[model samples]
Target: MRSRSWVRTVALGAVLLGAAAGQAQEGKMSQGVKAREQIEERYRWRLEDLYPTQEAWEADFKAVETDLQALGKCQGRLGKSAKGLGGCLDLQFSLTKRFYRLSTYAQQLNDQDGAAVQGQELNDRAGKLGTRLAAETAWVEPELLAVPARKMAALRKARALGPYGHFLDNILRRRAHVLGKDEERVVARAGDMANLPYTAYNVLSTLNLPFPEFTTRAGEKVRLNQAQYTRLRTSPDRDERRRVFQAFFAALRSFRESYAGLISGAVSRDHFYTQVRGYRGDLESALDATNVPTAIYTNMLEQVRAGRPLLWRYLRLRTQLLGLDKLTYSDLYPSIVPSVEMPIPFDQARGTILEALAALGPEVKAILEEAFASRWIDVYPNAGKRSGAYMSGSGYDVHPYILLNYVDSFDAMSTAAHELGHAVHSYLANKAQPFHYSGYPTFTAEVASTANENLLRLFLTARETDPKRRLFLLGEYLESWRTTVFRQALFAEFELKIHELAAAGKPLTADLLDATYLELLKEYYGVAEGVVEIDPLYAIEWAYIPHFYYNFYMFQYTTSFIASVAIAERIFSGDAAARDGYLAMLRAGGSLYPVELLKLGGVDMTTAAPYQVAFKSLEKTLAEVEQLAAKK
Candidate 1:
């Protein structure tokens, strides 16, 4: 469900798109990361869960590729009749499932060890296979639409086509946008070039970028890689954090020209598609894939802007807790409860997450138990392993696999809960729906994950008798909001502005991008209002975020975080119907539109009430933390 760099369209929807958020693993980073074989088997994910061995994976890949090639034989014949169409549809989903399985396996293996020659080979093969499938099946929609109108209506109602009704209907609904077969192939063939910018960025950031070993103020010599910077940014020593910030951003700023060009190319790719597809712009084209209204994106920006006072309120609280004269950009990452430590070892994390998510019922508990037991997760950072955390639940027949650079901190534990939320959502969807409809859309993707996080926060805050730790837990919830809700909206707005800039024919340069980013940083952190000083040093922060390449993917984090807050509150209130409805929505999956799915889950994202509830909840929680801080 989550990945890096590329996304490919499939029978159901945009199946393998990546969203950039290094959502977790904010603990200490190993200066010298251990080799993969150095980790215990239990800590390593069993890709054997998907395939027993590389030979098995290769065989499956060959079979899937061959089947995909065979599907090309059915191209123009798709409009022939109900049975013929249904047969082709069945083969399409069937092969896509195997294709996805192949992709997940290769990709995860590659991430688990980026330097592995086998991983690189298999990953490259998978990418080529995806391109082949795209070029081969490019005629599907256009041909499906070419069916005679009366016959197509009958096909929609045909019992043989019942499972594919929604999938077929989605294709038909995109009639105005679906290109002719030849044009579609032309676009599909452009996949490799279209992916060049992000691919380069991902390669540079993940593999090739050189991070210097910097000495901390404590005289701790550490390699300031992505994970290390993430961990050290939380250092309580102000001057030390300032040094870390300077070093990290200075490193990123050094490569700003390349990052700027790569991002501009990304925008240009979006721009080209926008023009080719007859969309107004990139945002609409991205959101429209799943029938999501662009209004929700704009509304999220407006709502977060409206909630800026709360942000400043929280920032002030943070300053007070840290005993700061004033907050600055470097002050952002250190825990407000600097004295409290929540170091959760990986084993302890399993029990903690299981207990936190217990309200989701026995089924979810069973899944978590299995997830921990079955080695469904790769649980530690290793030399050459991918950074950050993500859960892939796209392989319908196989269980979800999570990749975590777990260093045994509270954030690492929270990452487990968050990713497991995605796992359970996928498990339930796969269990309840046919493969054709097993995948949920991007809109609802974060709801379950963030809900699990809320559950963890609430559970910890309630039982934590240690006042300091309780404060830590409560502050973490607020921080989660700041990062997910506030930070993401800022990203969404920045993404919008840049795309608009490109659309207006302004060429993006490193300086221009930095200036634009600096402007947003000032506004969002309330520099003008003195909430937090926006250092120009952090202007290159955009270069560090991988999500800038996510093609309007950042806004979903804010919306889903808001939705999860509402969902978690209902369940916490003992609203039995709400809990059941929410679980049902997980099970509903891609069977319904995302808005309808949220309604089924007892929160209508289309209405103002959910957003209202979320903001009110933030206020109440802020008041609680403020009261507790007052006692201090």
Candidate 2:
């Protein structure tokens, strides 16, 4: 993955490997996790792929610093000639390649053990170096845009600039928003202040605010961190899950005022940027960054809202299978059927994921095998290691690296499949496109990953002959759509509403937020139709989602999942053209805009057809699950 802008990273944690959203740290680890040194060498990633030694890393670090001066030499010369522009771009890519390699090494090292001071120092230095590189290359874009249109057209025709035509076109497309140097400098200065709200929220949630631990009804006492709260939600014990939910929300409620204030400030920051960029509103501003149209956003919300019947049906299915008189928000987590916990060992997961993704064809299968054999993955949890899973493809010149705390569950296996999708996508992109086009945008980023996840689920469902386990697997598949599409679309609606409210001069207080969220929850969950009940206290659930700080990011998960369903269905049905088209997409990377690329890959988000396909898939699974539930 290319480096995310720091402000967005601060908001979203920059999980670039594009695994399924809402992943939890679940499953059994023997005793507690181990220290990094205790893990066997084969299980850990070989950072040597990047640099053989710390000394080599330091050498490259200095080399990048030295090369920074050469970029400055191209600053005023970009518009002089096509060759001048091409030279500056080539130099920028060269310097950026080296800089990212150094940064990736330090970042992986630091993530391995965040408590280590030396690792922290190295990561910090890499961050500062990136800022320096940004400063040095800041003139290139504005200068290129300043060039006369006819001159840019002539430059585009130059053989030297052939590979960068799309790149230059993107800059020209944003010419209206690209400010003059002095004004750009002023906006850039304000960029430094934009992270304050997010920083404050991080500090409050992750560090300062106190969340007391709660003991489950089964006598296991658990601390109420974000991961623990997630793991406890699916507890077999209904009372236990309720205790977990109440306790977790109670903590969030206690800090309601503080959270309300912080989130309000974050919304204001978004509004500020939207206005400065001359966008009509926050949604337009946020979507414009990815060159997505406002229609795609509106269309997603509209489709999901219109698909409420499917959601209500799924909710009713859950109630019937769980043997509850009525469903409540607290009852939503337990598996619809008695879940067959498939404890897939690490080696088994590796093999299973390889087989599951074989539908993408032999080339993808080969890439997955390499990912396993080449030590491209760091595959277990250790003391002070980062929580959750992600793929760091920042090593553009090298193979992608994946970080996994692989707990032995079916979900863990699915995570493996999802992240390997990202890894292989990066592998193909980096191999097929130049360095500049190698990194894909977030709009299409989750397509390959989520498609892999769907493929894995379909593979598992096909093989499970036992009726009960098949039902469980089917429910698992439906639950994925519930969370990824239906639920995230709901989140997208809430985010849009809140942003609109703030932009319209409505003060966002805890009460207002809670009421708005509660109303939406009831509407989507069909509380009025008696599909589920929303407890008033659960209205504060929005306060718990860290992704709200991510500024209109949750919708892509829905859009991408919808597109992937269409793509995966075609490939799984043995369509040769679809398979080739999907492969072409993975290889295209950022060479095309996300919407265009998805269209080429057989799913077009601009229309409602793909969303209808997704809903049909959900409806089909729900019908099967409903029939299976009758047998129970």
Candidate 3:
């Protein structure tokens, strides 16, 4: 994957260009042409929602600094008495809430205008404040660990401290591994520097490196950057797709040593942190930090491996439908049933999404409608707008913001539905839970979003009566499974092997990484049907994925898709019981572990039932596509 530095550099470049455009437009305001509204005016996100003014933000910033300083006073008192501990907890929570508000405002401002000097300043200031806060609160856990388990249980039962029972218990449960104050400070300080490797990689990938040019079908040359690369990847023409793959990776390969250094640095950083914190391995350490079981990660890989035959079968179907003698990696993208492009405008997309979600009833639909009606979304791609899409929700004190470089297309429409699922999840959690528990863990986060996408897919499939369009919808469904489940699982497998190798004191040089990745690509795509040819250069392809920086995070995409398919199936089958259970799961938030929460929603990740069911859906869709293609 590109280093974080490279990502930031790319982000900074986009911001700079965006700022220049904004300034130029401001200068031309006097011309007869209408002036574009400031970002604030164009959107309903209302930065005021986070902080009414710059002055208010500054006031809170100073207040948090002062409050954080006072937290030091409670350092040794956590074990003193129930009252002392309770007081300390209250202070910590209050300080966190205040800091969150300030940080949210700063971050939202920066995200909206990455090039703005003031926004950048606020972001940096908030980051520094956060580091100071972490240092001050570093003592809380260690101090809590000082208390005996029996005494902690007694304090938990005390009426005065009843409200914070969960908070106290959670901290105490991890007491065995909790480090001392000095150690914690060192770990905290190392974090800022630890991020440097990724930052460096990002800078090189996004700004420093020169992208190669590709010739389109029209003989027109296009310089391939991140945005254009994405478009080319999805091009309908197979040759165009092949050209993109070759050119893009060729550029990346030119800087092989630089990419290798960044990745090595990141691996080293992870190992350092693991050793300092007394972890068995980096993989274990990463999973432990997120409170997820290692078995969940391993189980996902095992299940995906077992399901490879089904994937092969699906690929064979695609080969037949596309009337190709042999399928290559490039063939996996373009539409198989291309009757019409069917580009849905943003407004229509919003309406379609709301209407599809009507199954969740009026209340759910109302919230979604509000998201569309409110200026919460920054729609359309303008010069310098960030590439891709994300739904960002800092906390309940602020509303969610959905950013899209939307180009009216079917895929873009599905992306809108997917992101809103995240927004709704945040909305529900924030509304129901306290600030402490408002955020769900990353494991369960993708469930709601994927479920929304599945629901929208079902809606679109049902509404389309034409055979070709219906086939298109089904083709999309099959592709989603392929991409989200199979593709991500492949990534998960590669990530695990690399980390394991690193932790075992083995070399993870670019050559070794590339070989391992290419092997997996061959295993996943090199089935008996000969649909896709997994290229050798694609091995180093793993270096470009950002998710590796996230540490075993991509697997959830596969797991969540399977889980969502199960839930969506139940809802579509008119199972009122299933629908209710799924809704309750959403509302349950972080109160339950992901596995348990998924069980409540009628899918058990511990078992292979969900995977089998989801794969069956893939098989069924492929069969339908084959039938349609045969008819023509």
Question: Judged by TM-score, which candidate is best?
Answer: 2
What are the per-residue Cα lDDT tens digits for candidate 2 across 157-177? 889898898888788988777
Candidate 3: RMSD to truth? 5.5
TM-score of 1: 0.82
lDDT of each: 0.82, 0.82, 0.74
Residue-level lDDT of model 1, residues 1-632, one tens digit each, is: 33211110110023334232232222334459898899999999988889998889989987886777679778778877778888888888888888899999989888888778888898999989888887777668777887876878976777888888778777787777767768978988887798788778877876677787899887889989887887888898899889889988888888889999999999999888888889988888988888888888888888788889899999999999899999998998887875566688988988888887888888888988999999999999998887767788877898988988888788778878888999899999999999988888877877888788888887887788887787777776788778878988898999999999989989999888999999988888888898998778789988887677768877777888899999998887678898999999999989988888989999877667788888888898799889988999
Q: Of 2 and 3, which scores higher on TM-score?
A: 2
Ranking by TM-score: 2, 3, 1
TM-score, every prediction: 0.82, 0.90, 0.83
Alpha-carbon deviation at 237 in model 1, angstroms: 3.1
Please give the clash total of every predicted structure, in order: 0, 1, 18
Worst 10 residues of 3 by lDDT: 1-10
> Over the stretch 395-445, how does candidate 3's per-residue lDDT look in tens digits?
466677777656688878877887888888888777777766677776677
- Candidate with better TM-score, 1 vs 2: 2
Q: List the residue pairs that clash in candidate 1.
A: none
